[model samples]
Target chain A: MIETKDLRFRYSDTLPFVLEGLNVTIKRGSFVAILGHNGSGKSTFAKHLNAILLPSGGKVLVDGMDTVDEDRLYDIRQHVGMVFQNPDNQIVATLVEEDVAFGPENLGVPQKEIRVRVDEALRAVGMYDFRDRATYQLSGGQKQRVAIAGIIAMRPRCVVLDEPTAMLDPVGRREVMRAIHDMNRTLGITVVLITHHMNEAVDADRVLVIDHGKLLLDGTPREVFSQAETLYRADLAVPQPVELIYALRRDGVDIPGDVLTVDECAEALYHLLKSRTNTRG
Target chain B: MLKDISLGQYIPGTSVIHRMDPRLKIVLTLAYIVVLFMAKGPLSYGLVLLTLGLIIVLSRIGVRFVLRSVRPLLFIILFTAVLNMFHVDGDVLWSWWILKITRQGIETAIYMALRIAMLISGTFVLLNYTTSPIMLTDGIEQLLGPLKRIHVPVHELAMMMTIALRFIPTLIEETDKIMSAQKARGADFETGNVIRRAKALIPMLVPLFVSAFRRADELAVAMECRCYRGSEGRTRLRTLKLQGLDYVAIAIAAVLAAGIITLGVVLP
Candidate 1:
């Protein structure tokens, strides 16, 4: 489990705090998605999880280990691996397999074990075939997958992906999103995905809405998307089908505001239309 | 002179030279240079030119690439040829006041110019038409690995070369973007005096530096996050292998060098 207590951070001594009085607790084995606008402190929070940035006030604890403690910083980081927004920024090695082995090698894993973990990580991300390939020659999605595999090789309990799909095209986005979901469901690894795409958030075990450095909503996907007006006021766009269903219900149609997915929306609409036909008959 | 540098513009292809180990290629380059500089008279010069011509043909690298490599050195060749022509005090074929073109002078000037051109062209054709910068640097690091015993920071040098190679395309792309951004703001790089032109570069330079530093910092953090402490215990995926072809290539170079050296010694 990861927990933060009254976490506050300022970019510098003279600057205003970027994160203010923020408090969040993530449960073990839960896939949580963080949604926020630009400068909403989502990325800043991700950094704190890995001890990449220490809090100026309050504390962050990873698996009950405090990030502020210098001795435990590396230990904390090893538990909470992070994948950044830009795929280009995170990959270190020139070849695909070598890049994956980077983290394990740093931790001084044995050569044989490193090779095993590297191959496993690559295979997990469906990029094992690219082991001998030059990393620079890969596409954005492939590169991001390599970055993800790099983190996975660390075998961290929680993987914090900060908009890993942002720079990718539609196809690339699906590839990364699929891999992130796989890590969450199959591996049972705790995943904290910070993204602006609402559609990407629906499958999360929990959704966190952070606006202007304050927790706006904390609930399951159904509870969060139910509050459509709040999301609009926060300058966040809800998933299209959810928004349409919400607006339709608000206009006195008998649909529900809680249809967070296209398939669910379709099912709900089919039932509503059938009832209307029955009422006419 | 620096601006004219063609730098690492190697073409991609499968050829005998390209297939050889870069370590051997570097060694052969050195050996070839030693032989060429020691070479004297027409016979040795003909052999050197002929060997280079054959390699160029076998490698399938075009004559245009060799010409391009030699183009920038035209002025230097002409100056050296002129100097050798007037300076050599041997059997005169033509004369003027303080200017004499002796048989030895004329021959020496032609041979020197041809040697320099052919030598440069040969090395470049190998470097540019075959080996990649990454492989070249890796080969160099492997070759220089012995220096680590003397505490010479060989790994660091190799790392620096790798990073520099990694950033060249990125920096070029960044500079292009900055130039375009400034152009959008009506900044002209072409229209100004020496001072104005230097000043005009300020906008482009500042952003390029900022972006470069940002990229460097990002790279450092990324590298560190992966636990890259240094070269200690690090291993390579593509280990340097001196293949059968590599040995054959070396033998060929040696034969050429021996032939050239013999011609240089035996010629009148």
Candidate 2:
């Protein structure tokens, strides 16, 4: 669990605030996605969850431990893991299993336990088969999965991923998203995903849309995306399915506007066509 | 094409030598070097060569692969041998203008070349070809643990080395990408004099440096998020424990060193 209270941050005294008087809370075992355009401070917010970047003006508490407390830094980090965007940069080891073990090792876990955690984490990410493979030899999806495994090996209660799938291909994105969801569901770990991808946020229990260092919209995928005009004004787009529903509605097709997934969109269209056929018959 | 260059000389295997504790291997390699330099005569050199031969065979890495490690240094070895052969004055077996090919000179040349070659081949087979780079750094870190009392940042240095080794291939891939991008934009890297070619690299180097710095920054944050706060209170997954094979290897190294030293004194 993470709680941020009017959190504000700036890189330096001269620079303007990147995050300004923003408040957000991430519940334990919940999947939350923060959506924003580039430089909208979503990553800055993710970093705050794990104390990678301490708030300049307000408080960030990881399960009741303050991020500003120097002594609880490792404790806070262990409770909330952060996965960065670049798979190549985040992996500290040359080998897959070794990199996964890095986080557990840093936490001072016993050698045997570290091994167990590494294997378990790799398996959770569907990368158990590639445990001994060289990190560079892996595909983009596999590498991102390995990065996720590295974080979960520490057995953190929460994970904050900053645009993890931004650099990945479509297939790689799917692979990483599946791994993230597996951790959230099977492992019961809280997941805070930061991304600009509308589809990535579509499945989240809650989506917080950020704009210019402030919370612009906060609701479920359907609620956040239904306000398509506002999201567009913030230089963001709805998921393609939601966009399609909105487009049809604009053409006076009288369709539901809450479709967030392709399946839902297809079902709506199918029912609409079936009703039309019945009327004609 | 650059990706084909193996970053480290390690050839992965499950051979006895590969399974040896890297700390013991490092110590034995150092001891072997000492004995190698102490070698004086043909008998001593022969013993040294025999020890290296035994290690190469035990490594299961093949003699050819072990010898390949010596290829890059062939020029230096030949240069040293030639210098020693011409400079050493002894019984002249042949005469040239100012260069006399003496029996002792020839013997010295052969011994010098043999020592250098065996030295490299022994380490390559015993250490590089067997131990992974991570294990090698781990061994160095533990071996230098005592130096921490003297205010040495041994863990940090080893950590830096480990990270550097990890990023080498990634950086190489980036370099390949940058080179291709430049080539696509009509940047000529192939044809020119040495200086011209060097100048052409400026474009590639600038972006490479920028990207490398960005990666470094992101990596630091990632490492911090993983709770990596230097080596303090850290545990390792693969702890270096000496096994029976390691002790046997150590005993062999000790015997080889003592035998070579004794042979040098006895035969001299």
Error of 2 at B87 (Å): 2.7
Per-model C-alpha lDDT, please?
0.84, 0.90
- What docking tier does model 1 reach? acceptable
Q: What digit string (tens of lDDT, one per residue) describes model 2 on residues B145-264?
A: 999999999999999999998888889999999999999999999999999999999999999999999999989988988988888889988888898888887787888889999998
Q: Look at candidate 2 and give me any clashing residue pairs.
A: none
- lDDT per residue for candidate 1 within B102-175, as digits (tens), equals 99898878987998898789888777667877678888898998999999898789878877765665566567
The alpha-carbon deviation from the true structure for residue B142 of candidate 1, after best TM-score superposition, in angstroms, is 2.9
How well does candidate 2 reproduce the true complex, by DockQ?
0.86
Query: Taking the candidates in order, what DockQ does each have?
Result: 0.28, 0.86
lDDT of 2 at B141: 93
> Which candidate's lDDT is highest?
2
lDDT of 2: 0.90
